[model samples]
Target: MSHPPDIPETDAGPAATPESEESLEVLRDILFRHYRERIAELEAELKRLETRLTDPQILSAIIAPALGNAIRQKIRDAREEMIEALYPIIGQTVVRAVSEAIRDLARTLDAQMRTSFNPMRAVRRVQARVSGVSSAEMLLRESLPFEVEEVFLIHRETGLLLWHISRDPEESADSDLIGGMLTAIRDFAQEAFGRGEEGQLDEIQYGDRRILIEAAQHAYLAVVVDGIEPPGFRAEMRERIITVDHTHEETLREYDGDPTPLQPVEQPLRSLITSAQPQELSPTQKRLLAGFAAVVLLCAAAFCAGGSYLWQTVRRTPTPAPVVIVPTPT
Candidate 1:
C-alpha cells in the first residue's frame, strides 16, 4: 500500500562512515609510536653521557708503573702539572671541607623551607643541626698542627658560649676575661650579620699567659691553644657562622639566645701558637725585648750620672786651687 522505497539518485555518492575515521586514527597512532621510540632512544643516550661525566674512573691504574715504561713519561708529566696546580693541598683541606659543609647546610635548609609552611621552627631546626656538632674539635685536632686546649661553642646571635670543653685540669680562668670575650663576641656578631666586618683582636691578660681573642658572628669560638698566632681557625669558623647566618637568620628568622647558663670559664690552654714572622715575635720574644730594653736604659742612666758628678767636683775645686796659689806667691 505504501509507495515503493525511493532508490538513491544515481549522482549521489556513498556517505562518509565512522569506520573510515577509525582507520585514519590507527595510522596516527602508529606514527606517534614511532616518534616516541625515537625520543626514548635519544633520552637513553643523554643518560649515558651524564653517568660518564659523574662517574670518573680511578686514575691509579692508568698511571701505575706496571702498565709500561712508555706511559710512565706521560704519567709523570700529568702528576707534575697536578702538583703545581694544587699547591699546599693538604693545608687547604679544612677550608675546602668547611666550605662544603656550609653548602650542604644551605641546601638542607632550602629543602626544609620548601616542605614546611612556617619558617620560624624550620630555621631553628636548621641552626640546631649546624651548631650541634660536638665533634668539631676532634675532627679539627687531627688536621691542625698544635694541640687543642679548649674548644668553645657559642650562639652567634647572643655572643654566649653554649658549651666549653677544655683539656687542662688545673687551669682556672678569670670571670672578667670571659665577660670581656662575650662582649667582643656580641660586637663581632652584630657587625658580621649586619655589615660583614671581619673581626677585631682583643687580648685577655691572664697573669703570664694571654688569651688571644677574636670576634665571630653569632659566637666567639675560641681555642685557648698555646702560642701567639691567631689560629687560622678564623676562616673555617667564619665560614660556618656565615653559612648559618645566611641560611638561618635571613630567611628563617630563627635566633638563638644565651641558651647555656652563664658558667665559669674552666677551660685551660692546652696548646699555644704564635705567628711566624720576624717582625711580629711570640710572647717570649716580646718579654725578652722588654727585659733587654730595661737593662740598656739602666746602664745608660748610670753612665750619665757618673760623668755629671765628676764634672761638678772638678769645677768646684778649680777656683780654690787658683786662690791658694796666688796667696803663696805674695
Candidate 2:
C-alpha cells in the first residue's frame, strides 16, 4: 500500500493548490474583460455606419438614380397640392397687377383724349393737309418730323419680339431689349395701379417721340412715331395689325422666337411708310409753275393796255368821219 501511494503522489501532487486556482481565475477574468470591450467597440462602429447610411446626402447618392422615375411620379402626384397652396397668393397678385394696369390705362386715355380734342390740334390737322405735310410734322416742326420711325411686333405673354421694322435700321439693333423693356414697363404700370387682365398700356410719350401700342389677344404692335398722329393713322395701324394677326394667326400662335416667318409683314409696314410720306412738289414742277404764272400776268397786262389805246384813238377821230359818211349816203 505504501509503494502505490508514492507512485500516485508523483503526478497528482499540485492538484489542490490555491495559487494555481487563483491564477486560472485571473486569466478567465482578463479574457472576459477584453472580449466585452471588443464587442462594445464593434457595436459602436456598427451604429456609426448605420447613422451614415441614413444621412440624406449619402442616401440620395445611393438611391436617386434608381428611383428617379418614382421620385418624379411622387412630385407629379403632389403637384395639385402645390398649386392649391400657391393659388391664392398668385391669384391675388395677378388681380392686383391687373387692377393697377387698368387704372393707369384709364388715366392715360383720359389725358390723351383731352390733349387730342384741343382747338390747336384741329388747326394743326388742317394745316397739315393744306401744306402737304404730316400732322406730326405740322405740330412739332422744330423737333422731329411726325413719322412712324419704328414698328415692333411682340408676344404679349413672353415679351418676345416677333418682328421689328425701323425706318432707321440702326434703331433695330436693340429691338429685343426694347421689347423686354416695354413689357416690363407695362407690367410695372399694371402692378403699380392694380390693373387687371383687361388693362394695358396703350401709349408712351417721351418729348416729341411717342410709342403707340395696340394690343390683341396674343400679341401687340408698338409703333414709334415722332409728331402728332392722326386718328385715321391710328385706325389704319389697327387695321393693319388686325390683318396681320388674322393672316398669321397660326404662325404667331406657333412662333418659337424665329423672325423669318414674319418677313411677309415687312411689305405691309413698308406700305405704311409710303402712305405716310406727303407728296411734295419737285423742283422741276415748282419751276414750271412759276414760269407759267409769269407768262399769264404779262399777257393780261398787254391786253389791258391795248384796249385802252384803241378806245382813246376811237374817241379822238372816229365820230367825225362816221357822221360825214352818213350825211353823204342820205
Compared with the true structure, all predictions reach lDDT values of: 0.53, 0.78
**Candidate 1 local lDDT, 232-300, one digit each (tens):** 655544554455344334322343444333332222111112222112445875676678669989999
How far residue 13's Cα lies from its native spot in candidate 1, in Å, is 99
**TM-score of candidate 2 to 2 decimals:** 0.45
Per-candidate TM-scores read 0.25, 0.45
Runs of candidate 2 with Cα error greater than 4 angstroms are 1-144, 194-197, 280-317, 321-330
